[model samples]
Target: MAEGRSEIRLSPSLRGRIERFLAAAGPALEEFPPLETQKLVSELYVHQMELHLRNEELRRKQVVVQRFLHRQEEIQSEERFRSMAQTAIDAVISTDERGRIISWNQGAQAIFGYQEDEVLDQHLAILFPERYRAACRRKVERRRFSGMVPFPGKAMELHGLRQDGGEFPLELSLSRWEAGANSGYTAIIRDISKRWALTLALEGAAHKWRTTFDAIGDGVFLLNLDYEILQCNHAMSDQVRKPFGEIIGRRCHKVVHRRSSPIDGCPFVRMKKSRRRETLILRRDDCWFKIAVDPILDDDGNLRGGVHVTTDITTMMLAQEALKETLARLKRNMDETVAVLAATAGSRDPYTAGHQHNVAQLACAIAREMGLSPEQFEGIRVIGLLHDIGKVAVPAELLSKPGKLSELEFGIIKSHSLMGYEILKRIEFPWPVALAVLQHHERLDGSGYPGRLPGAEICLEAKIIAVADVVEAMSSHRPYRSSLGIDRALEEIFQGRGVCYDPEIVDACISLFTQKGFSFGQEPFLILSPADETGAAQGGPGPGREPAAVRSEETPVQKGKSAAKKSGGLEGRQ
Candidate 1:
């Protein structure tokens, strides 16, 4: 038993020594099997070798994968750069230090109409027109002085030569860079054909506007918010007696009116604040101008300045003022003539003494209500006063009779319109005043007595006077009848609208008398023109007399007596 115990102690120490030796050698021979070891130790060594082999395989695979990923990143970066360069609208070309073409993008192909093969390795001067080649070389030399910025955002107008030898305008921006020890320039060029055309058109429009402003018979100016003269045309300069350059930057009041401050309702100031137009009479030292100011706006509709257009109305206003006296005299003479003529017609029939004068007053009112132009309205007023002047041709005995006229006498009265036309045709007035007299009896639908003119052909002025004439004739007392009320006169016109009178004029007249509460009668004659001297001398009413009678009459003795006095009035008017 003691011998067995000693053997056990020796076995344990020997096993511990064997385990230490295996641990020390395990790392160096991890893949190799230990041939001198026991079978169990050899089996452990084989398992460790298999695990080391698998780890080595996995490390090799990881290294291959990392290399592939780095290469993929480089390819993607190149692709992105290429895409950006291709999409540009301007031509981009790069050249080597020796001035030979290096990289040509698609934009370069489009601008110069040259394929990459045609331009690559060629001189950069090939893209320049012959006329600009020398200039381009000087430009290239100047680039050395400039710090190289990228070839864009710098606009320089230049000429480019296409492959077909045609030349086009271009805007170029250039950059110089170093790549792999080679110096080069990248020129970005854009064709400016469309832009140049638009520029030329804008220049032409500006020139036309300037020409119009300068050559116009009136004055024109551009003003800033402070009312300084920003621009003035030749006419304005002439008016102010100053040179254009001298006038510019000077206050408008100082240059024009010799004043240091603005006047009330200053057009320029009003235009700036309101962004609208303002018109007023501008008085300078010796000139009166109708000046209009309009605001100038930018592309975004921002107010930039004011434009002032001035029309010289001094001469016109002076002429109107000068003619005042002559007009007054003419008016007085016309009143006397109308009264005498109207009274002569009425005197034959006492009951109709104030009929024509009252009609004239009513006709003038109707003309005002119709919104007729000033000239037309004036013509109506005159013609309304003298409308029945031709009735003097009728016999007095028939006119004063307090009974209905025979058909023959009535037929004769109908000739008054034609007679009036013939009587006034020789007088040259600014208006066709005689035409209004003749047409006043005509109708819109061609249904009235006389000329039978239809719509539009019946002048607006005539339509108004016609309605007034009918109303006056019907409302006033006649020798054969009593006075018809205003309502009856209106009903007559209302019934005749669109048939005997213009609907608008009839409606306007109705509105004036019925709705507006305007009344007529007992007013003196508003004479427009004189009667013949032969008619005037026959014991007729004088100026300021009431209206004459409604008569279709004349006396042979009265015609002979008035001939001389009527001739003098005609000569004076002429």
Candidate 2:
């Protein structure tokens, strides 16, 4: 056993100490046995080698424990990374440099409708549309997958193919990793079908709105309170004869109206103040423009801005102005013709030269005082002016006679009313002038005239003229009679009120003479030259009566008689 273990080496310190002990006790222990000494050295050397072997055994076990612990930590780290990747909302996929799918997480299965076992080792091109497959293949060939490719591509939008063969839009982010000499790629992908559709819908709606705005034919624009043209349609450019570049963002008055500022009473100003629609008619150059401004409001009912619409109305307005001018010219011509006709009739009886014309003035005044409208009174005036126009048909001797005439002459005098109707009925007057003329001598009780028509059958115009006629006839001087004065003429109508005349008209006539200052001369008359007078006479006493002196209360009746008078009383007069 000693020889078997004798190969064990002695420690340097033990060998050195044993040699020194022998040297110090030189020959003192020479008597000790060689076998015992060899046995003792061998035992010591064996123990030292055994201790070093034991220490080496413990170190080997320690290395094994450290390796096992480090391996567990690595396993835990891998599990943590896998758990994070699986639960992510986006698809997490891994592929080799060959572009074959190597790893698939739960999100990848959910997004692509595939189990993890279904897609491993498959080409990554399966996830992309056919059009994008070739581009991805090209990127893979370059071994630099970035920017719209599979590796290190930051959030790029691309088409994705699902297990169902349906294609949809997706957002993808890419990253690459290296394991030894080989590389792998990870892609984070998100389905964006709803988001993409929403973006497209918004764009379509905006395009449709702009199209509708450009379809209007009239000039239309949006305006703010400051008169800035916020937006305008295509037609607005045509109206102002400018391009959209010049008009938009400029003031409306400056762009459209060609003014430095808004004009007085501008429709835009009015619309803002009133918060309602308003219109303005403007004449620019040779054209007429009608501007319609409508208000725009906020949801809270506050005035925000306005919409201005413009229309061209030059043709219509110009026609109206021309028609008005033509009518005026026609009226002047008619007046001249009427003057000539009035002068001709007056020549036949000198004393009543302006009688019909003066009757016209009084009749119009009475019609107004009675609350009659302008339409009613205007007709009355024309009828009164030409009331006695038929006297021209009667003999001068009969009309100018000083005393009451024979029954034959009286009948002839009464025929003048019918004759006046015959003369006027041929003309197409807007009013019933002819009928009123024939009924002027007619009474309410059927006690007078060529027609014995009662009050109800008489036109209101004829009644008004009758009151004025009687008053004028009795008050003015006539060749056949002296002036009876206005007091008696007024008394005549008052006494005949509701009997021979209309009560309302009588009251209106009285009010004029008493309450309102009315004189027949207040109106202008058609006066003929002395050359046209011929046998016409001036105002004075008639027949055997001397000229009456002017009384203090001479009365408007005397002055009015000069406006209209008959040769005799109601019994016989023209």
Candidate 3:
């Protein structure tokens, strides 16, 4: 205190505050300082002002450093985002509020076939199909200020235009982003061409199958294991007299049969047990239906359910019934005509009254043994019954004479075959009846009367008749000759086999007598098994049962006739 002045020191802030107070209180405070102290107060004030200016400069530089650090962080964040978008399989695009392209990722470049340099600053509408371009531009313009909201995860589908001018389907999802005074939209887009094509193909296939299902004329339905109809076609609806809507999702039995349970003899029920197709003919509502069931199996071959198909067979059954009646009537009338013809021819010769009948029966038996078809045998029988018809033209005394005929009478007998052929040729029989009658007396070795055809020229029917006529004539009573007995008759044909008669027909005739125990006057002759084509020993109707035939290959006797009918290449059954 004593040495005239006290020293003073202050921090910059303190100095500044004190200087502010000194200036604001300057009139009194200026004098309060000692004269030396007062002189330095201005210098203190000047130093304080310089320090304040330096602090203001430092604060301004700190603000600049903070801004630089923030900009670096933003740059790093944007680089990371760009990297992610570049690697994405889908297109990623960024646009300004004006919809101008600002950033295009590698994915977007690949999808759109455009480089970033080419697309940058271009309108986003360049990537949209022509139809969508104007709409997209108008949409962005309308929302230029507010921009779009943050899009949800769901994507919108549209068509995208490519650099090649081709359009492909696209799925677009976008989100809104804002940074300071800047705001824009980022969109993720996917190419959906393959997916769209697959969907269309599936729709087309479904349409084709549905069309085929409905086009079927038969009533068809898919049945589950529970017998419920999962689906039914139009024909099925028609059959049940119900709409398709009423049939689906209902029990099959309830829909078709109008029953609580399955109908009796239901093919579906039988198929469950057999696991094979089962069919049934059902008659209901005056209509005939053929119901066929096929099983649907799983991959393991286990039965799953069934497909029921109902076909209307009313017309077919009725036609079959009508045909059967027509055939029966024709058969009866023909049989009567054959019997009458035989009787009229035999009437002239009193002893040969039953001779023609005996010959016809014996010829049929031989034909049967020789593996002839029913048609061939039938032709043989008809020819045998009428073989002597020409005898009717002769005087009654000549046929009934008790002595051997003169050479002139024998010549007359030989001419009967041609006469019978001439008479029978006028009728339209289904077989070669006239030719067979004409050749019945012809011999294989060219020794017999009339045409005297060789074995090859003679039809199978005539060959059979020749052997049967000889055997029957020798065994039976005749006015011109004594009964030689059955053994002698068979021996005659057996010795002449392949000489005067067809060896096959001769052997067949012998077998009928020796093995088959066949005789004349028997009402019912044997009708062998249809499968005895190899001449297996079909059991006889009565006492006669023959062993298996000796012939190894007995070809169909009427194969030529059957073929002729098919090709129209010959006369009637020729």
Candidate 4:
């Protein structure tokens, strides 16, 4: 029955099924022509089937090629990320919110001395020193609560632990990072030993600069552009007579002078504007400060502020002024002394008393009219008084001789001018006081005595004294002659103007005497003696002669022995 069932069925449905199945199995079976023809047809069908299978295989290969290219793209992308992570200098480390290390790059390994295998899946606390663990944990808790790390672009210096328990300084910048569905922190760390060294060096430099500034002996002050005192050393307070606590952080003008603001001539402003050092004279009560304001510059050459250095010059300036005043006083005192001395010396003759004083007064009047500085005037006054100082060495008998002097006696009297210079040259004085005495007899045209210097060579003071000597000797009663009137005295100077005397000075003298009605006898002379403290001798203040006080300054020569000397010597001499 099995063999019969295998035979072909004649029912139409079954037969069609069998035929279709046979044709599918072998297409040549449906043809069933001759056996040999069928074999040939089957061969041809098999050849076609083989060709279709080759086409299917080709399609499958194309799909495989596309998949390979897609996979290669993925591999390249992963390689690029790995390369960046491996070569980056800044440590790239990732940790879970709970402080577990999840990923670590080569940079992290190099900086922390740990391999990825040693740190990955480990607690983040392993990297922190034991002491910092609490702090680090607290920071992480804060970060988790805020969903942000405290550090971003700004890096914080800290210590990093190595795999071998070693430590190093590092700058760490932390940020929150998300990987797929997981949250973590990324920390970028840089070894910063070099930066730390620089920071220390900068601190040291700052300390040294402050020390140097404070150690200076001179008064030092720092001011802002607004002339506000920023800082000051102890010396500044001492010099200005103000306390440092009161001066610092206050406007300089207000603190120094108790004013509301800076004055127009404030030196700090000028220094800041000019970016250069400027010197100013500061007047305090009876003292002076030379304030030098120098610009403070930054490394980039920008003006930052100013440095004020104040030098106390009150002593030196006062000394100079005192010296000037002393010379003046000395001249007047000397004139009075000489007048008294001459009176004593000439008491025997009686007629020659007050001779030197009259001559000196007339000479000073002439010199002042010639327009000289106070120093020059003082020189003239001194020479006029001392012109006869050497005559002290001359015989009293010859001086009081009443009759006309012999040629030898006249020559001896003429030698007094030279002798006076030699006597007075030892005394230190400004403006060649002794030279004026020596050259008093000299003429501009070289026609006078004692090395007669001509024109400019003759001191204006000497020329004036020469004119005055002739006038006073001729006008006053002398032992040998009668008095000549003032008009005759004027003629000598007027004729000798420019040729013997300085023309301008001679003109001033002429104006004073002739036009200004100045005369030696205008004021009566008061008696002065060593016993008279109120007198014009002994360098005390006289009746109407007093010194004017400088603003906010103490007198250079106070009312003491020095003051006495100055006042007594120069009183009424000018």
List, residue by residue over 401-498, the lDDT tens digit for candidate 2.
Answer: 87656778778888888988998898777789899988898889997788788999988878887888887877777767776677667766765778
Task: Supply the global lDDT for candidate 1.
Answer: 0.67
lDDT (Cα) of model 4? 0.66
* Number of the predicted model whose lDDT against the real structure is largest: 2
| Residues forming the 10-long window of minimal summed lDDT in candidate 4 | 565-574
Cα RMSD to the true fold for all candidates: 14.8, 12.8, 13.1, 16.6
Model 2 score (lDDT): 0.77
Please give the TM-score that candidate 4 achieves against the real structure.
0.56
Ranking by TM-score: 3, 2, 4, 1
TM-score of each: 0.48, 0.58, 0.66, 0.56
Instruction: Please say which candidate is ahead in TM-score: 1 or 3.
Output: 3
Worst 10 residues of 1 by lDDT: 565-574
Q: lDDT tens string, model 3, 1-574?
A: 2232333447787677667766766678655547646556777777668766766666788789999999999999999998998899999999988889898988888888999999999998899877877777887887532222234555778889999898999888876689999988888899999999999999999999899999999999999889999889999899999998899999999998889999889999999999999999999878999999999999999988899999999999999899999888998899898778778876667555577778888888887788888888788788878877766776666665555456676566567778788888998999988888888777788865687678889888888877777777656665444554665555555556667777667766665655565668775654445343322132221133222222235322233223222323211100
Compared with the true structure, what per-residue lDDT tens digits does model 1 show for residues 1-574? 2311211222465567567767866877554455645664765566567656766666788789898998898689868856877788788788766556887888888888899998889878788877656555555556541332233446578678899999888987777777456687877788999999999999999999888878888788888777888888998888878997789999998887678897778777778778999989966667678989999899999988888888999998788778997898886887676567667656655533455566567777776776767776666666666666656665655554455555666556667667767777886666666787677777777755576677678776677777787677656655445554565566556656666767767777665554454567533323334331121122222233322323226332232112212322110000
* Candidate 3 similarity to native, TM-score: 0.66
- In TM-score terms, which candidate is top? 3
